[model samples]
Target: MRIGVVTFPGSLDDRDAGRAVRVAGGEAVALWHGDADLHGVDAVVLPGGFSYGDYLRCGAIARFAPVMQPLVDAARGGLPVLGICNGFQTLCESHLLPGALIRNDHRKFVCRDQRLRVESTATAWTSGYEQGQEIVVPLKNGEGGFVADQRTLDELEAEGRVVVRYLDDNPNGSYRDIAGITNARGNVVGLMPHPEHAVESLTGPTTDGLGFFTSVLEGLIRA
Candidate 1:
């Protein structure tokens, strides 16, 4: 499977995301932020970064990039899309996902190995995990708090769209301790934690995050 990893102007983890894709047995295609063409890739990852130096809010500016036009269209057509950290902010800004990531409650940047529970395995990126399974991955962000109105929050919980929930500790004060969530169709996921950073035991805290990449690959193959 060909997985495209988009690199915006200040993308920090595009290479790591590409490596994760390759490690999971998928072809990693480098995608430029200014290009609208998706290169016919089967899936796409919006890697974490300080795009445009996080100007005009975390992902506000990056959402207007030319590449986002096609990405938005493809994502709506059910193409698998994974957004991590800053990427998650972009997803929300693009209206592909709901809610917004705000400043951390503690008003500080946080980086740590965060424990999370798999709340749903229905999404393309999380099918490899068992429901309620626990895993740890690296989490790093300044404005990582997730918030939405009560209606949206309740809807997300009721629809089983909450893909992952923080365990033991809520590092960023995300509502309901949500670490990640999926779209209603389950093809799009936005996660705050960096799964790419946890794909290898040699460099990461654990190899638990490999499931995310492998899950998408397996789903693409089955399709």
Candidate 2:
């Protein structure tokens, strides 16, 4: 029940991510990009932000941080990792997840409450949702478009790796409106939406996002 939220230089939503973990009835551990240790956290969250100011592509530089190496290893070993927004870009750059997030098709930053359908409820971060369930979460990013080779796309589809999909319309021109995806092992997940921001009702995105954090806690407990 201990969730660590990693904060890279220039990370904006690390605090919010930690707060979400706390609200979900888990311990929140703050992790720094320069640190190499995970402090025995049961799970980790790569929160959104313009890491390294998004200087050379969204998450290119931040991927080389000390904290990410252990994350990659832990994630592969079945420790749950949730990456949001810029964090999604980092996951792709780290090769923990396939595909790259490109500039929005409109060539501008898009920010709104995005409605998404839970395409797969079997992953560690999505078990709280039933298949075909709809949830609203805030998504704000300039490089949220997802692209991959045709073969990889087909593989993802066949393997049921796609976790969430845009409901009504594609928000940022992502292929097949892929809102989120899980690794083959189903322990790691990455998405462009800001689920942490939607954890509270005052923000008005809906309380649905709480399921994501709670899902991990429940999954860990079951394991």
lDDT agreement with native, every candidate = 0.95, 0.91
Q: How close is candidate 1 to the true structure, as a TM-score?
A: 0.99
TM for every model, in the order presented, reads 0.99, 0.98
Candidate 1's C-alpha runs over 4 A off are: none
| Candidate that scores best on TM-score | 1
Give the top-scoring candidate (lDDT).
1
Error of 2 at 110 (Å): 0.7
Among all windows of 10 consecutive residues in model 1, the one with the lowest summed lDDT is 164-173
Which tens-of-lDDT digit does each residue in 2-93 have in candidate 1? 99999999999999999999999999999999998999999999999999999889999999999999999999999999999999999999
With a 3 Å backbone cut-off (N, CA, C), the pairs that clash in candidate 2 are none
Instruction: Please give the range of 10 consecutive residues that has the lowest summed lDDT in model 2.
Output: 199-208
Clashes of each: 0, 0
